[model samples]
Target: MSHKQALIIYNPLSGKRKKHSAFPILLNKLSEIGYHLTVNEINEVNNMNNPIRKACTQKWDAIFIAGGDGTVNQTIQFLAEEEFRPNIGVFPFGTSNEFAKFMRVPNNIIDVVSVIESGCITPVDLGKFGNRYFINIAAAGWLADITYETPPFLKSKFGELAYCLYFFKKLLFKKPSDNISINISDTVFSDLSLFLIMNGNSVGPLERLIDEKICDDGYFHLLTYKKTTRIKLLFHLFAKLLNLSKDLSIIQHTKINEADFMLPESISLNLDGELASVNSSYFQVLPQHLNVFGSNKNN
Candidate 1:
């Protein structure tokens, strides 16, 4: 029998304190499961000879990603362009690691290796907005700016809390305003403070952003917050986050297979957790498009 070939692309700077310790454990366990492993440590972003690019040149049975959402998104962009894509195994070793959290991938290296060895794979959905693909979320409006606006230094030092601090800073000082239009299922939302199209319920540290379990459903969860006062919106958001409120009337949500948005040139769209360069306003969900190593219970 031919051994299954696997490639590991990991960001050297991610989860610095834990990654070094986890590295050897990851290699030994996967090898035990009959995978011939080739490892690549990422030192810089956009290196033409990056591991993701290298993985594309060969027929890898699986690709293990060890980083945050931004790193995952970069990999998705490259893989989506190929006709034959390998299954994904995620190691949550970066700030927030929202995508891995959504996958219910355990943070412990030992357990993560077990999941891969279990051979349980889930067919997951991916969202295509303009030219890029996202597995977790595609968002825009009010607070979405925090994704890119927070300095890298802050993210590196404080992790997800840096985004929270920046959020409140913008909330107290900047008025919540946006000129955008969303059309889904023939319904139009012309005025929205913020909007998110989520494949999973978790975003940043708020685990139940949608208050329900989201899975590989064929549709995206479209959550749109109507225009409202900054202070009022903040309180309501907190209420929802804390599970104090089951429903917020100002926030309209529904399941959608596709949607279109008219965004201002000044407004930046956040894909996963990074800034998205999208020219087209159209967005569509490709159901069960990718196979990921995750348990079905996570859904």
Candidate 2:
């Protein structure tokens, strides 16, 4: 028996080009902290679901994700589908690390390991997209489409620059999502190019884009850009990254708790960089859903 039992699900193939190998360090740290780690390394996406489902069913004392956003999203999707759930911790070992960035988890594996070893659990919000769930953001549209097109390996090496390149590539090709319809609760919106239903304060490398105070406020933050030209898309990203725009520009940012959507076609969705889809559906915020180790401000 161990002082504290923890279940760690990780993706060994994650990270940029699979270059960052932090599993050894993470294991050493968890051992030092007395957590009997039941580690599972995912060889494929579905491999994650079973381990997480089993851990939650048995109620592991703490659940720690040790990969990038893709692994985290898959694990959360599995956990959200189950009846039993446990508090979660993180160690950033993947590329982009967008969710980790939003959680203020250290980019370095060792630093994040320290944060988890301290045993501080913070409750954070999760966005429920149809029956599936997302931890950082659920997004669709032009910019989001780039998430799928960009090579996953590029995300690890270049980080946010990878997105910028793909966005521009799509823009050059005049590629955009079919004009879609969105309904946020009672209000209906049309001719939208993209929408980001989010809970984390930051996405990708835009740390300041999301204000930290609103993260745990029982609300989900959203940003959308109306039907506009490629030039306008460039400006939208520029404004969001530079903080030239705020959360209420009619085409920039807003806070949303729930939304029902109808897409023109079966468009791909980027949920924390993981490609997901459901026949055009509904989403809402599950406030304080999981006990998570994250930014201390909300805890």
Predicted structure with the largest TM-score when compared to the true one: 1
Compared to the true structure, candidate 2 yields what TM-score? Answer: 0.89
Question: TM-scores, in order shown?
Answer: 0.90, 0.89
Residue-level lDDT tens digits of model 2 in 103-126 = 677777677777876766678888
lDDT of 1 by residue, 161-244 (tens): 888899889887888767778987777888788888898776777776775665577888888887788878777777776878
- What is the lDDT, from 0 to 100, of the residue 50 in candidate 2? 78
Q: Clashing pairs in model 2?
A: 247-253
Clashes of 1: 0
Q: Which stretches of candidate 2 lie over 4 Å from their true place?
A: 17-19, 44-49, 156-160, 210-212, 245-252, 296-299
* lDDT per model vs. reference: 0.80, 0.74
lDDT at 298, model 1:
37
Model 1 scores a TM of 0.90
